[model samples]
Target: MNIQDKLSPTAKEIPPSGIRKFFDLVVATEGVISLGVGEPDFITPWHIRESSIHSLEKGITSYTSNAGLLELREEISKYLETGFSLKYSPQNELMVTVGASEAIDIALRALVSSGDEVLVVEPAYVSYSPCVILAGGTPVSVPTFQKDDFKLMPDALESKITAKTKAIIMCFPNNPTGAIMEKEDLEKIAKIIDKHDLIVISDEVYAELTYGKRHVSIASLPGMKDRTINIGGLSKSFAMTGWRIGYVAAHPEIIGAMLKIHQYTILCAPIMGQVAALEAMKNGHNEMKKMIEQYDQRRRLIVKGFQEMGLSCHTPKGAFYAFPSIQATGYDDHVFAEELLKETKVAVVPGSVFGEGGKGFIRCSYATSYSKISEALERIEKFVTPRLNGTCDKVI
Candidate 1:
């Protein structure tokens, strides 16, 4: 039987996640100081874990309502209101999902239909393009350059829109580049979005991890609330990646459409995760702030290290990633990352896997400890020194 031929063509066409490919390699190897995966190195905080333990001890393991525990939704809604000035009704406009991964997937699936095109901002999270394709929608790449700090330009965005363009999927405090879009930046892009009359899938998973400025949701801007799908989660902020707790705030109508897909496929997010998320939402702010401070220190450390080593790096304003151009090393990103891993046992993800704008760069995450990041910096500098041969121009 030709079983492969019988499978959905779309499923076959989808490539495996690039982030996990290097991660798998790191796992099979030994002594690799990894800066590949974007996950925080911190264990889930003690209090949040206690909350889950308390739930399981009480025998509360059954699935909650498909939209998730109502109390959790209420906390998420309150968090959004207090943090971003965006109000949502826990009963109708909010939903809990397995993680921001599931939230991104369902948001695309809910809004995109066959023959529709979703504009994906380039150098985005690895899943954005694939999720759009899996939803049976065409993905149109809207490239942003490093020269602009990888911010989505209004002209570049509008140029990609057409009658078939159904929505735009964008992440600020972007995954690979670690760039952020402040209120002024968002206001400009929002003007283009408003003019085009399109829906937006704004992934603000790193919203709380900014260095100096606060995150401003494009959805919070006037006239954008009704047309935006706001994605957030505890995965990064609370160091709860394994717990798989995430949420969405959108128009009630959009939430209803997404609920159909979620209830059928996921049924409900794990009840224990919902419980833990509630605890985090209510009391995890101080710990989150402490983690942010550590990330800021490491961010400065890593970016400065790259610049000193003669590789040009933008000082990331948000998130814990440092994306440095490898052109000075006379190698493309893929070759540099692979060769770095093979020679020095240091693992970093190549930028090309992220999209076209990332071709000559590499993404090094600073979500680990200060000493570990410092050691990785030493290894990276040693690896690059001979390759540049003293002719490299210092960008610092």
Candidate 2:
């Protein structure tokens, strides 16, 4: 029997995450200062972790309801309303997922059918297109450019639509670029969405991390609440990545379909994680604010560092990434990333892995410590300065 023949074609066709490839590479190499992965370097807040520990101490080990602990669902509902002015019923319209990642997967699985096309904003999270493919849908890339601060233009979105377009998956305070859409910008896209009658899977995992302006949920727009699936989690905001807790809010019909899939596939999110998430919703804001402040400082530092080194970099409005163009180095993204890692022992992700519009850039994460970010910047400068100055010798 050929083992390869027994696997689903889609599962086989799914490529490994390019981010993970570099992440693993950094792990294998000693003394490398990595700014590649998007994960926050902070430990989970003490109060949230304590809540989970208390739950486990009480032997609350059994599964909750399929949709999750009703208390958690209620907290999520309240959080969404308070944070983004979106209301969802805990009983029928909300679900606790293992993470925003799972929320995204089940949303696509629930909404898309074979032969359907789902519009994905390019330079997108690495998981979106693959998850759409896994759900048996065609993943259509709707490109957004650096010149636009990576915002998805209404015209660009409208151009990707067809009768077969079932939905769109969008991440705001986007990964790799950290681009955020303001309220008016969202209104424009929301109008286009309404005109096309398209469903939106709005992944606002970084909603709390926006700087300078608040994140506007497209679902909050008039007539959009019914058609959008809102996804978010405790990972980025509460520094709870290991907890794997997230949720989806939508119309009860859509939630019911997603719940059915969640029931069969996940049964319930981990009880401890759900407990942590509930605490996060209720009291994690203070800790999140402190972390976000530090990230903002580092974001400015890294962006300035790249600019001083003669790399064209956009100031990220949210999230913890700095995307700088390496086009002047006469290297494609992969070559630049690999050469930087080899020469400086400083790892960053090549932009090509993110999709079409990312080819000339590289993503450096500012989620690590400020000192490490500064050191990495110095190392990168040392490595790139000679090349930028048209010299071939090492200065140090």
Off by over 4 Å in 2: 392-396
Q: Per-residue lDDT tens digits of candidate 2, residues 285-379?
A: 89999999999999999999999999999999988899999877777788788888988999999998999889989999999999999999999
lDDT of candidates 1 onward, in order: 0.92, 0.92
Report the lDDT tens digits of candidate 1 across residue range 1-396. Answer: 999989998899898988899999999999999999999999989999999999899999998999999999999988999999999999999999999999999999998889999999999889999999999999999998889999999989989999999899999888989899988989999988888899999999999989888999999999999999999999999999999999999999999999999999999999999999999999999999999999999999999999999999998988889999998777878878988899888899999898888898999999999998999989999989988895543332
Q: Root-mean-square deviation of each candidate, in angstroms? A: 2.5, 2.1
**For model 2, which pairs clash?**
none
Reference-based TM-score of each model: 0.97, 0.97
List the pairs of residues colliding in candidate 1.
none
